[model samples]
Target: MKGLILAAGRGSRLLPISATRPKHTLPVGGVPIIMRAVQALREAGIDDIGIVTSASSEAALRDVTLGSGHLTFIRQAEALGTGDATLCARTFLEGQPTLLYLGDNLFGDSLRPVMDALDGADAVIGVKRVPNPQAYGVAVVEGGLLRRLVEKPRTPESDLAACGVFAFQPRVLDDVADLPPSTRGEIEFPEALTAILARGGRVRALEFTGFWSDAGTPRDLLDTNAYFLAELRPRVQGQVVNSQVTGTVVVEPGAVVENCTLTGPVWIGPHARVSGSAVGPFVSIGAHSHVSGASIRDSLVDAFTRVQSPERALSRAVVGRHALIGPPGEEGLQLVVGDRSVVRL
Candidate 1:
């Protein structure tokens, strides 16, 4: 089966970081967010992947998917809603059954169950019970079928929020073709789902008990790193020396560390170097990044970034690629830097 990954959003909530790179390219657990999505699809026996992206992010997507032959990239000229982004790939889908994933969501369970469920269903969407359903697109399920879907209803009838993983037969494209723009001037996917349901299409909701996180904002990104680390740390390999690592911590191969304290639920990417730094308890250091003479807690540092001497960063901050930080003279505590930015904190 083919897969479609929607990664076209500008991620305004993420601000400076999203200004330079797409949200899908943000690092989680030392890997790009979209890479996790791709691996999940591949594990589900769906190697053929199509990514919907805006023109600004086309190059980044290509760079990330390099050497993955089963991947295809489609450009969505306008930043339309989810429906319009999916419609951009209608020609590529070509009447084939496909899996759809939101680029920002990190999944813990294998997607095979949803793939298997598509045998008898026209569409299958992954759902999870959220504490507050009013903030999400919720599904009302009766028996095993989805009775109704409300897009961010003020008073949700159910707590089963759509987890953004979907399986749809090609015919669903017809429902999206004539969709008018939503209030935000983008084609909304929930409307397409509603249309399909109205046409007597079999839309099934699969409740997932396993871990899933939507990293839409800075806080969500940090929380996702913590969640995945807690669940998948033992399986990852890395050397721990002179550090206190609790929960799930993944240190990739070829990473160097010395005179540093590392708390659990952290990930240090391949070839990363950390020296005289204190990190952890919800932190992710990207590939080839360097942190020296710094103390960072609860932050995501992107690839090739350098946190220079005497800097201290704390709580829900994202540092982008190729960033440089000079010495900090005990002045500030929080720093959020974008890609290719240089700052003397």
Candidate 2:
């Protein structure tokens, strides 16, 4: 089975981070978010993947998936809604049964069950009960079939929120093509789902009770990191020196830790360096990064970053790649720096 990953949206909520890299490229547990999706598809026996991306993200997307033969890229010229992004991959789809995943959504369960159910249904949508369905594309399911879908209704009739994972027969492309642009000037997938329902197409809902998260905003990313860490429990594997650690922590191979205090629930990626610092409780240091003479708690430091003395970063922050923090005389406080950014203080 082929898979379609919709990664075209410009993640405005993520701001500076998304400005430099696509949301899919954001690191979660030291791995790019989209790579996680790719692994999930591969694990489900679907190696052939098609990614629909906006032109702005083409280069970064290619760089991330380098040497992956089963992957293909299609450019969506506009940030049209989910329906249009899926339509961008229509040429490569070639009438095969396809699995569609939102680039931002992460699921804990294997996708095989939904894939199996797709054989008998026109479309299979992953749904989960959420406390606030009114904020999502809510689904009403009856007798194991999806009865209706209301897109962000003010008063939702159900708690079954669409989780943005869908398996659809190729014929669903027709519905996508026929959909007119929504008031927001983007082709909406919920509209296509509605069209399918009106045509007597059976839409199956897989009520997943496992872990799932969509990292659309900064807070969401932090929450997802904590959620996955509950299960991942990454352990430090490389040499350590002069560091104090407490609780659960994972340091990947070749990582260096010295003169640092790492509280539990922290992950230091491969080849990363943690020196003369107080880290963790909730922290993820990306590969090849260095942190010294600093205090970081509840933060994510991306690849190749350097955090020197007189630096203190607190709750819910992301420091991007190749960044330099703390020049000669700088104040210590909370900071979120983008890729290649430099801060004097």
Candidate number with greatest lDDT: 2
Per-candidate TM vs. native? 0.88, 0.91
Q: After superposition, how far is residue 6 of candidate 1 from its true place, in Å?
A: 1.1
lDDT of 2 by residue, 263-296 (tens): 8788888999889888877788899998888888
Consecutive 10-residue window with the lowest summed lDDT within model 1: 336-345
- The clash number for model 1 is 3
Q: Candidate 1 has what TM-score?
A: 0.88
Return the clash pairs for model 2, or none: 234-250, 235-250, 235-251, 236-250, 236-251, 330-345
| Model 2 TM-score (2 dp) | 0.91
Error of 1 at 134 (Å): 1.2
Q: Per-residue CA lDDT of candidate 1, range 109-208, in tens?
A: 8999998888888888899999989989999999878889988999899999999898888888888887788878878876777888888888888999
Off by over 4 Å in 1: 232-249, 311-313, 325-345
List candidate 2 segments past 4 Å from native: 67-69, 311-313, 327-345
Estimate the overall C-alpha local distance difference test score of candidate 1: 0.82
